[model samples]
Target: MQMLQLSAEAYWGVIAHAQAAVPLEACGLLAAVQGKDLVSEFFPMRNAAESAQLYRLDDAEYLQVEQIADARKLRLVAVMHSHTHTTAYPSPTDVRDASAFDPFGALLYVIVSLKHVDPVLRCYRIVGGQISEVSVEVQW
Candidate 1:
């Protein structure tokens, strides 16, 4: 199984952002130095869709964040979003939207489900409309 590494701070930051979004879905990017699966930074973003069941990264913020990551020598390793009332698994909409990503880039898709009392985070690789789960390692 493929694995993605994240510092405890980065991992918690994602969960916190999800909680903070409350009734709306939260979205963000996880960055890493080029060529590494270990995430080094987290960029929480405003949800353009502003819906409890969906999320869309603000286009302007996406571009700005991309530029910022480029300047910092970081590559966005994953796109993350919160599912305000569902499972951590990707939905059909997610698979369809993931087609917008480069098939060869190996980018990760992370979903944080807020259906239960505890937050549930799951990582996935969506390529050619196929969904495969990836393991997440929260390292201290």
Candidate 2:
């Protein structure tokens, strides 16, 4: 397993939104800060598709997230999306689509499980059409 260090506040915020989007998948972006080490910050993205079957980052929303990172002088660290009914693992489709969606390889895929009212989040790195578990630590 790999490890992702993130701010405590940001982690909770992501989980909150994930729960709120229950029954539907949630999506968001992560800003990576590089210092002595790497830390990521989560920024929520609106789920435009009420159906929750798909996710797309519009230019406006994308810009908003980018601006926030820019304001803090951070880099686009990762992209996150949730699965409503599936496990907190990447589906085959997810692996196939990851390449096009994230080319930088900095994108860490996060999946939230809606199997219960309280969702569970798991991180993964999709590479070469394979998904590998990534360890994550929520820093308080």
Candidate 3:
């Protein structure tokens, strides 16, 4: 099984962004030291889709974030987004989008679900159209 380690700050940053974007999906990028699985930074990004059920990282924003990560010597670990009315599972659209965007299956996809009273965060790896859950470890 795969695992993603996140710093406490990064964990809360994701939740805060998700809640703040309520009604519309929020998206962001996760970064960590090169070749490591522990995430040390979260880059909140504008959702180009701007829809409650869909999300797209703006092209310019994506490039900017990539540059920042490169300068910091960090790897782009994953792409995160929120689901306002669903569980913390990848939707069909998510699967399709992942395949289209990440053909090499390099980045993990993290989903934050706000359907219930409590928020749920789940990580996944979508490769070759197959979706598999990845465990997340929140470090203090």
Best by lDDT: 3
Question: How does each model score on lDDT?
Answer: 0.90, 0.74, 0.95
Model 1 off-target regions past 4 Å? 103-105
* Ranking 1 against 2 by lDDT, winner: 1
lDDT tens per residue, model 1, 1-140? 28989988899999999999999989999999887768979999999998987788899999999999999999988999999888999999888778775566368998999999999999999988898899999998
**Candidate 3 clash pair list:** none
Which portions of model 3 show Cα errors greater than 4 Å?
none
lDDT of 1: 0.90
Query: What 10-residue stretch in candidate 2 is worst by lDDT?
Result: 32-41
Give, for candidate 1, the lowest lDDT window spanning 10 residues.
97-106
RMSD of each predicted structure: 1.4, 2.2, 1.0
TM-score of each: 0.94, 0.84, 0.97
Candidate 1 differs from the real structure by a C-alpha RMSD in angstroms, to one decimal, of 1.4
Winner on TM-score between 1 and 3 is 3
Best to worst by TM-score, what's the order?
3, 1, 2
Q: Judging by lDDT, tell me the better candidate of 1 and 3.
A: 3
Clashing pairs in 1: none
lDDT of 2 at 89: 84
